[model samples]
Target: MILKTIFLGLEAGGKSIVIMNGDDAERLGVLSLGRVAIRFNGEEKTAIVHKSSKLADPGTIGVCKRVWSDLGLSEGAEVVVEAASFPDSLYFIRNKLAGRKLGSDEMREIVEDTVAEKLSDVELSAFVTALHSFGLDLDEATYLSLAMIETGRTMKLDGGPIVDKHSIGGVPGDKTTLLVVPLVAAAGLLIPKSSSRAITSPAGTADRAEVLMPVTLDLDEMRGVVERTGGAVVWGGAVHLAPADDIFVKVEYPLSIDPLLLPSIMSKKRAVGADLLVVDIPTGRGAKVKTIGEADLLAKDFMEIGSRLGITVRCAVTYGEEPIGSAIGPALEAREALEALMNMGTAPDLVDKATAIAGMILEMAGRSDGKVLAEELLRSGRAVEKMREIIAAQGGDPDITPDDIVVGEERLTIESGRPGHVLWINNSSVAEVAKAAGCPKDRGAGILLHKKIGEVVGEGEPLFTIVAERTSNLRRAQERLEKARILAVGDRMEMLIHEVKERPVVKRSFNLDR
Candidate 1:
């Protein structure tokens, strides 16, 4: 069918097409080649017929044709379009991409096609935005989750009750995963965890874990490691689990949209075949869940979704007003996590959070005796031993110690200005300092807090230390600390502005009809 249209602009790569007047484009479907009739302002204009290949290349057109064919659209169907209508067309495309009652094979196709970079960033963004806006129903989320799982490599363990934990993230310095996995595994639970690298922060779980041992593991190696040592900490990026989630994350991270966050979390857990899951939801200023109420709602949602997915989900709403551990960078966090697990050093907050989380996992696995069991496993060297076994199994040095983990060459110390109690610590500011120090990149670059909130410090006492590989980074981090009002030395903490702003009302007119 012939359609009238105007060519808008070119997309990054080909995939450009003339826009028609109506939504019949979906009905006409995508054409490898089509005719366009342009009409301006209700007046018939000249036809601007062009080949679809002119918009993109032959390869892109072929892919589009294949995708359209998969959608069961017919060729030569009349399509009404306009260049300005691309945005709306995106929505239609996304809905189709989400698919209704999709099978495992179809889901696999989506993931493979997506990873091949067949979809442009804009198209990917549209699909993600549509899922976020319309919300993925349980069935759809399950399908999508399963699809993502199968698209990438799958690690199979020859056992049940494989224990694992995950944090929904969006909080910097919540390095509980690094600590919890080792702690649980040390307790003799089969815990094979896959973590992500940093997206916005300077350090992610994978980054931090890499500080101690290698995190990049193939699927076979991962399964072998888990089988041999009963646990392994590795990077998820290396092995795809819920790959679509990764694509969506590229969009969600920048926009901070998490409408389907709970599903995403549970789906990953389900995909990994974690029978028991402990989800840490940090709630406070600068965290994903900003309030206790919101955190509770999310916790409930996660538990319910997990149940539906045949997994047990337990959530903890931890304090996130500040960094959980003294370390913030990948290497620094890894060093600290190892130290804590090995019982060689102590970061009370980190230790407490880890023990609490590990305890919960142990409880779910029916080995609960609170921190007693957790501390015993850690202090008796069982956890450390397990960690060593896992590390060695994963191709890392089992004898690696905290001292073995190197730090940046350049370092700077932050001193207390006044002799008073540390009232508050701003997590976001701390993350900024760590980022400036090059935590994830430098591995050794990060901030180590010597004092925490409620701790009394003398004037000129060392408050924190910034480590970096370069002098410039040290100075940059120091400069950031100079301007950062992260710590408050007073009796009371400053309150945040949490009130919502009111919008002005607009008058409306209506008539009653008989």
Candidate 2:
């Protein structure tokens, strides 16, 4: 317990070493050299671990084996120690840490402290991997959500019926946020929307919004924008709300593990002071939730969790077997979303879905006839006006047109091979192709869908077009699209079936004793 000196080196077997005093070693239950612990003197502290090399001075104490043993290690154990405390960062680890399973409370504390800059990245990664492996149950997820909320900034708006919409994201070119926010806002509702940048898509809502005006705004600026326009689209990362979720996403992205953090996802909206919420769960062969059952379960979880968190959650299970809109990149999708708002775009599916979703938000926000209100807003140009106000508030010219937004000069058209019905357009393929085309970064890079599924196409008609700032990216996009066969056409329409075949049961058993 007394003040002690610190020494660092390696042990005989090449394990890191730390040196401490005899009294400390005895108190720590170390009987032999080569142990691990910490020593503090005044304001300085150092780690003591087993060192492979010999000590230069006899005065330097060797770490005791009993202390190492007490510190917890199995046979053939090795330990590495560092002087710095774990910084508050999410850690990506390949193996599990040696410890008892974390309880809900402990996990919440870890996540909160980590986000608050109390834990190091390595420790955070360790904790993340632990959670990922053993998995967080509903209770744990709920606690984690609360912890995330406690650690970050929360917006407290005095307005009622503030609605927000979110998509689990997998399908590309789903720029519904652009239309939905304005439509709902124009219906005399509050929707201070915040979206993320592209993680795996050619463009994210935030990325697309950036095409027209700045999406990143500070807390005060965001609130002002929302108060002035009744709605504003901005990037969530610019705010510190649910900061841990952002860190978790960075780690979760490469792992491709859907933590399915329903509470965490909803908490951000709750944190933003949203009372009404619409969640879009895109389910299809190529989407994140591949099965209808999976999407349903996720939707239920989101709704249940949202209810518990004091938010009304309405889930929309939408079609994502293909891309949602005619545009599959940042600039293209931005252009398309703007045109759809102005009722100038031809992508009826995109407009329809956006209007439907926005209508739901409107209904929840007290619009008696949500669909009609939403349509009137769009057709009468109120939604477009709201969007213009939002754009102007976010530091952009309100009068900017879709054509005024310059795209990449490099473009390539995919012509129909033969006259037939367009059978399918794979969402994953479109996402990959657009990404290859340098979408979110290039702003001008993305794909424009000219022919949608079930549409009749002539041999000379264009199926889609790829645009990019670079010719190499255009070629890459073309190559990826060609490999995936995104635009499939045939004389006959392909029908998907769910059939069950039963086999006759054979009754036979062998006697093991015999």
Candidate 3:
């Protein structure tokens, strides 16, 4: 049926969509959420259909930005609309939903369609949920990784040993990347680090780094920075490496599931031509991997996948019972990282963790006393210098200092009620509080701890401070604190953790990060 085009001037998050009146939809033999083939000027495109009685007229079809641009449709242009069948990928997705493992061809087809925007959000959500429920075997995971790598852009850098590091993030305030990149690069190795923004956490590495430098660099610009300074910290979204993962992440965010974790990390590493890689698995209570055994199993999977993708892999099972440093938001973490790199302040745990990870990358690249060398790089002010160079290369201020970084002015300090030694810190609750304070979005909003696990605390002494750009956000965080116990302090361990007077509703915290 020939219909006039009405440009909607809006996007469906990269999906092609069209709206039509109920009468027009009935005449064309299509229903809402159905598919339609639109043809204009000898070009054809398929878009998901939405039916509206009043928004669209009987003789006109409303086109979204993506479809309108693809078809070169103008306002009141003539176009042909016909009912269309869904792609075969939907069938494969159905099979997965039925607890069937897909072959390599099926996986590749699904990934290709996903990149081509042939699958709608509902279809993609089904696929992601199926993987989460049924899970993927090693072979299936490998197939997905290769398919994603093939379907996305790749980088080929000329270097002897291109090293990279990743953390299966669960701990908050992890600005280790800010230190690791400069440390390893100062030791003469190529480290092109691409990180994600906050998914289910208060802050991600990219979010924190973005407080210091521009992270949204394209692939070419990323290469230029890496080539000049031997290191770079850019956002993965702009690079288009395994672009399908970006879409998958969007689906996984609301679902709180990440079945694609293996392929997601390995695919990006393969795309960047990383020869040696270290995956940090924060293990302990309050971390993703709650036990050392679980961490070891995860490490094995990572190593196996790296072997399949021709990248060497090692895992660092680090302590994750508490936040990495005193800071737990983007700006606060960035400032802490810079201070650590400059060796100006005493963040013993943060410095130790960063140097150890950087040392692993060094040792993987054939260096002796890797930890000592990494320490020297920081102590001698070389890592900070390298970081300055990287910042300048990425179009940020080279002379940026900790004090130069501004934080939120609205703040609240919680103090200890009783004197005791710090017993434990709840990572999830900490993240929740920071998120309530408008973290990541409000770069200056965050939390700073005055004490950590095993530290001494005095009655009425400061426990932690919450900072926010707005008083409303600070109040929101304070409200979250009333319901959540972020840390514990006591003279002795309490035998009774809690009392269950009746049937209790348990809410599990789900963390999804890359």
Candidate 4:
């Protein structure tokens, strides 16, 4: 159909969309949502079709601004329209939905279509849902990982033994990357770490790092920064690595990033040229991989995939029953990380966890007594200097001290309901409270713990502190936790009765924790 173009001046996601006249639709035997091929100014692309007599006059097509820009046409331009041919990957997606494994080439085609915007959100969601519903087999997962790596940009580091770590994030207040990277890098290793923002928790490695230094560096800039400082922490999204995984991530974990985590990790590490990788899988109640068996299987999968992709991998299962550090937000965690590196923070868990991971990296690099070397670096202040150098390289203030970190102005202190021994701290509840208080986005938003498991507190004594940019968020978080006992203050017998929720949501036994 020949029609006049009416630019619609809007974004229709990545798909090109055009509206057809009702009369023209009837003449062409088309429906309201048919596919069409739009052509103007020597350019043609497939577009989804909509019909409206009011929006466009007869014999005139309405185009979104994206289509107009693609055609290099202004309003009232002329174009030709025809039925569009659908891509073949949709059939493979349907096959997967029917419990069929996709071949490597088929998966590659689907991922390429995703990156090229040839697939709509609905179509892409179908792919993600299929993968989620019938989780990919190891072969399929490995192929999917390779396809993702092939389609996106990759980082090239000049040095051998590019060491990296993946904190399989589940526990709240687990911000040790800030300390471990500095610790490992101080010992003459190239550790270029790329992290993501928070998903289900208050903060992620990248989010917390952003509180101190810029995490969004382009590939070239990231390379330069690492070259200068021997290590750096940045966001993986900036480098265009495994971009198809990012799309699946958007569908599965809207504000999170855990769907198809196996591929996500392997592909990202492979893209960055990491030779040795340590995967931190925190296992316990209220955390992912709650059992040693599950963690072992996951670790084996990591090793298998790493072998398939030619990378050496290790998995560290750490305690995740409670928050790792004293703080649980961007700014607060950044400060706490620096304090831990400075050997001034009282968070023994944070210090122990950081040293443990750094020690693993040191051991991977053939160092003697990895834990001791890691501690020596942290205590000797060389890690602090390395951190300063990294901060400066990433466009942040090198001399910025922990005192300079600005946390939420509005705050509330949670006190113990009754005086007794602290039995446990629910990781999920604390993470939820902090997220409600406005995290990741609000740099100053977070939570601070005063008492942990096995500690004692008096009635009305401080248990934890909630900080937020707005008083409303702080109050909301407080209400959520008012009836929730994240920090139980009673004996094991009493603890069995008290739970994380107000009322009994589950018949949970304290046997595992005990």
Candidate 3 lDDT (Cα, whole model)? 0.94
lDDT of each: 0.67, 0.72, 0.94, 0.83
Worst 10 contiguous positions by lDDT, candidate 2: 505-514
lDDT of 4 by residue, 439-488 (tens): 87888998889988888788889988889999899888888886555777
- How far residue 421's Cα lies from its native spot in candidate 3, in Å, is 0.8
* TM-score for all models, in order of appearance: 0.76, 0.78, 0.98, 0.90
* Candidate structures ordered by lDDT, highest first: 3, 4, 2, 1
State the TM-score for model 2: 0.78
How many backbone collisions does model 3 have?
A: 0
Better of 1 and 3 by lDDT: 3
lDDT of 1 by residue, 1-514 (tens): 4432222333423232333322343344533223332232343221112344344232112113322332232433323333221323333445456654444454456555565444446566666666666666666666666666666555557776887888877666677776677678776678878888887677888887776678888767788888887888888867666666676676665565654465556666766678999888888876767899999987877787777778888998888777877777877787787888778666778888888889988998887485778877878877778878877887778888888888888878878777888987877677778878886788888888888878988999998888899999888888888766656775565586235578746422110000
In the range 1-514, model 3's lDDT, one tens digit per residue, is: 9999988887778788899999999987888888888888789898888889777998998889999888887899999888888899999999999999999999999999898787888999999999999999999999999999999999988876999999999999889999999999999999999999998999999999999999999999999999999999999999999999999998998888889999999999999999999999999989998999999999999999999999999999999899998999999999999999989775889999999999999999999999999999999999999999999999999999899999999999999999999999999999999999999899999999999999999999999999999999999999999998999999987898889999999987888887
**Which should have the higher lDDT, number 2 or number 3?**
3
**What is the Å distance of residue 460 in model 1 from its true position?**
1.5
Q: Which candidate gets the maximum TM-score versus the true structure?
A: 3
Candidate 2 on 1-514: residue-level lDDT in tens? Answer: 3322322223322222355445444555543332333432212223333222244222334443433333443332333322343322222222225434445566566666555434434454566677667776666667677778887888876676778999888788888899998888787788988888887677888888999999889878998998899888888889878887876765555555646357557768888899999998888877777788998888887887787788999989999888877888887888888899889966788888888898888788776777777888899999999999999999988998989888889999989889999987777677778878887799998888888888999888999888899999988887887666676877886575334478746422110000
Quote model 4's TM-score. 0.90
Question: What lDDT is reached at residue 105 by model 2?
Answer: 60
